[model samples]
Target chain A: MDSNGFRPEHRFDVELVAVTKRYGGTVAVDGVSLRIPRATYCCLLGPSGCGKTSTLRMIAGHEVISEGDVLIHDVNVTDLPPVQRGTAMMFQSYALFPHLNCLDNVAFSLKARGVPKPERHRRARDYLARVHLQDYAERLPGQLSGGQQQRVALARALITEPRILLLDEPLSALDPFLRGQVREELKRLQRELGITFIHVTHSQDEAMALADLMVIMEAGRIRQAGPPREIFERPADAFVARFIGGHNILRDGAGTIAVRADRCRLGIPEAGPHIRGRVAAVEYQGSSVRVALAVDGGPPLSVVMPDDRFFAGPVQPGEEAALTWSTRDAHALPDPA
Target chain B: MIGGGARSRDPREKRPWTFYALATLMGVFLLFLYGPMFVIYLLSFQGPNGGVTFPMVGVSTVWFEDILKPGQMANIPVAFGRSILLAAIVSTITVLVSVAAGLGFRRRFRGSGILFYLAVASLVMPSLLVGFGIGLGFQLFGWKADLFSSALAAQLTWTLPFGLFAMFAVFNRFNRAYEEAATDLGANAWQRLRWVTLPILLPGILGVAMGAFTLSYDEYARTTLVAGNRNTLPLEIYALISSSTSPTLFAIGTLTTTVSFLVIGATLAFVFRLQRRRALARHG
Candidate 1:
């Protein structure tokens, strides 16, 4: 067994023990601990200033941990440089070297390690081909489209062969249509490489689509950590329920609970918990139509209905509506700490 | 046809009165700027019997030849060599120090604000007074002031701030993600700087070098007290001006102005070539 008393089968690819980052009087990332398994796609999901990026940077060895330790492959890497930490970060902007062509950009890590020219170039070309960019070897980053640049960045990071790849909002810069395509490519890449991938993003949809383990963070702490389905079904608190969209948070005699928008029905049920409010909005989202309601004593709510179901009995914006959900669909959320 | 004619005429049919006024003002400004330089160029080619005036006595290159003879009052070639050497030194030092300072200032540290203000404060200080202070300090230390020593230090005070400010503008637009990406790709600190940072900042550094070179080449007031025994080109020209007036002075002026133009032209051509190469790759 290792010094941390973990069995061989239970060893995590990356582990953080109460890692904290403080700048002067303010704490940026306050005591975050996490464990990501081998080959798992883990996403740190949070809003701006929620320390998700800081946690990712700490794991990559880019930011120093003020309080605790960061361990990679069961080895403490808190004092090591990024190169020694076995982590590669793909930046949000892709950050490809503007002056270097695609081939040189991908070969940068090999060059840094003092590898000779022809060998590095050959290996770099192979990696580029993996990213489907072999034809654009000589093109500079500026010559490539936004999505192509991100692939080049991926190839550049992959050349290092790090055990864990840290992605900081890699798909945020792409257009919506391109974001989905790139997202699929990233997941396929992670699976094929069989390495742990830790991605940080503010988009709940992105996290839900890619993450095997979705970590919801708020104000430098993890609000909930589980599979996407688990977190979606049972958010730890009101904050997480709101941040992970399409959840209707309601408060009644039984305290706070979160119900999926798709599970919420418009007409009042014969029996079961229900909320009455004025219909605030009706939005058509191609396959699904969303109906937002303004409640008197609680936050606004929304109900997502199938387009066919919504059209059967259309509800106008100014009409009064009663939203009801089955008791099993309603999950209790703890009060915010 | 009527709609098309009206649409075409709408944009260009009328001229604003301010346009004519501004155009006339620009014309006069250009004439005022180049008027004396044109006269100096004409007078520099005056014949042996010619004077430094608009009425050319005869068309000859005698004054240009006279500039090479090393007259009793001045040694143009030696002073010119000294000026070039000093300016080169000053330019190199300014670029190196200011680029380093610019990178260091990216991160907030203790006394960073105070240090930045102190470095930039030299820009607004009177040049002569700064030279006088350096000269006085040399006297106190019993050190001899010369072109390479005290004068080099003095010129840096003038050029380094400009270099620092230029570098600030360069670094402002520079994305820190590039450096972080380099680091993540396993490059050490020095490797990241040499391969990534320096190549990206090269254009701004070149501009800083060119600026420092010209400023040092033409600097006279600051270098006056610090240049103890031997004189630089500008000081030599000043001495010649006080001693007498001749077409030879115009020759010297034209020669120096030509050198300045060549330096600026070469720098611009190099920067343009670098940009074009990048642009070509972007559109290729």
Candidate 2:
């Protein structure tokens, strides 16, 4: 949504129309349909081998679309090669060319497109400067740190000025601190460029932190696709609810319901529809304490309470406790078909 | 405890007895490998009337000078040139063919197993037998086995397998992500291969090329049966051995060794320069 009152025209940047990818007999991506809005950060979040990468590859034209079409900027690009699809992919390894220097790696696409050497170098230098890597243009990939190499990859991918950028597990190789920093940097770059950035990641925190449009996939199909807050607050199925962690899927008498750990309070059994369970484990996280419990010899349930609140009423690992959440706080998940 | 602190963590501690034993073994092995070559180098400095079997009469360049004059039966310069040309051709063909085959073998295809085994079989088979087989094939086709034709083929049979195996090892360490990244960055097949694949694998390719050149340059057995009219340096050296008992043979050996050293040294220098340039790029 823009500042103007009227809805903006040409909102959709990339559209995947019933896209299916099959590797021989096995289907990697089964008829996934999605519309990524322009200039927004979209994350395809899923576990490994769940078609998240395959979906990203198909959008980037690296994978062939078996059943349907992919459209970028309203142009059908399903059969087109990656170079002609107006999309650039940043590989998981960062894939910086070992033989090429930073400037040369960034300038490679322009050189391939037959840009003159001086002009390509000038443009490449501009992009390197944009990534604040101007001083390291002559350095080989091996000489730079992992984060620096990632920036080089980003700069190289951005040099083509594609309408959409596809990244596969963009920050999986980074350490925790660097991952956070780079994730912020990626968001900032996407905001500045005002182009669609479709990032694929397995971490729910990464997706929630970076995405305006969050897509949760399972087993080659999209379980849910919406804003991050919406998906977190209301996952469409059991798979999404479980995958997006910190949620306890409890089976009451009626049906299964997903309730966030923080929302479930430790209380006496008579207060509400309480689950009586023994404390299995207690993890003292800095901001919150996660109390793991087993209810009626069923699946384990956990409740996250603020550290100060939890210590005020600390329960030992062997003690019995009753857990209850308000009915309104519980989000019902669709039954598995 | 049986060895009592042999694996001590302290760096300043004395090394275990196994170290001395291994070092002594390595020393003896090196001596066994290079002792004969050192004697040949020393005997090459023999006097004009010196015999091939050592105890030098005097140091002279007379035998070395004899190599320049074309003999009644053998010409050292011509054979040396032929050896160089043949090795160059073999090296070039070996590198090109092996790199292509190596890239092809990266994917699993039908008959790849058969092709791989055939290469290994060619490598382990007797060199004379391979030469005889190629020579026989040429004869069966009513063709004369020459230095550039049948001899080149026989040498290739030896070097290609080495080059291919080298390439296999090289490609094994190669990451396909680089090529995928190239494709993602808008490089076509030829561009990806030329810019990404070859450059990254340059060091290994150079190693293979050097190995092929050296192998072909010094090869004798395979070329012996197939070489019909012309003689390579090794064959000429063999003929010189049968005909005369002079120190000229030692001189020829010394000269060929010198040339080999020069070629290998130049290649090492080239590869070093390439590495150094890339390294220095970081500081720059």
Instruction: Compute the lDDT for candidate 2.
Output: 0.89
For model 1, residues A1-337, the per-residue Cα lDDT tens digits are 7553534564899999998999778888888899888899999999999999999998988787899999888888899899887899999888888889999999999999999999999999999999999999998887788889889999999999988999999998888999999999999989999999999999999999999999999889988899999888778888888899889987656878888999999995577789889999999999999999998977889999999999999999989999999888888887656
i-RMS, each model, one decimal: 3.1, 4.3
Model 1: pairs clashing at backbone N, Cα or C within 3 Å: none
TM-score of chain B of 2: 0.92
Misplaced by over 4 Å in model 2 are: A1-11, A294-296, B1-27, B46-66, B69-74, B276-284
Tell me the tens digit of each residue's lDDT in model 2 across B181-248.
Answer: 88888888999999999988898899899999999999999999999988999999898789887878
- Worst 10-residue lDDT window for candidate 2 chain A reads A1-10
Q: What is the interface RMSD of candidate 2, in Å?
A: 4.3
- Report per-candidate DockQ: 0.47, 0.39
Per-model lDDT = 0.90, 0.89
DockQ agreement of candidate 1 with the native complex: 0.47
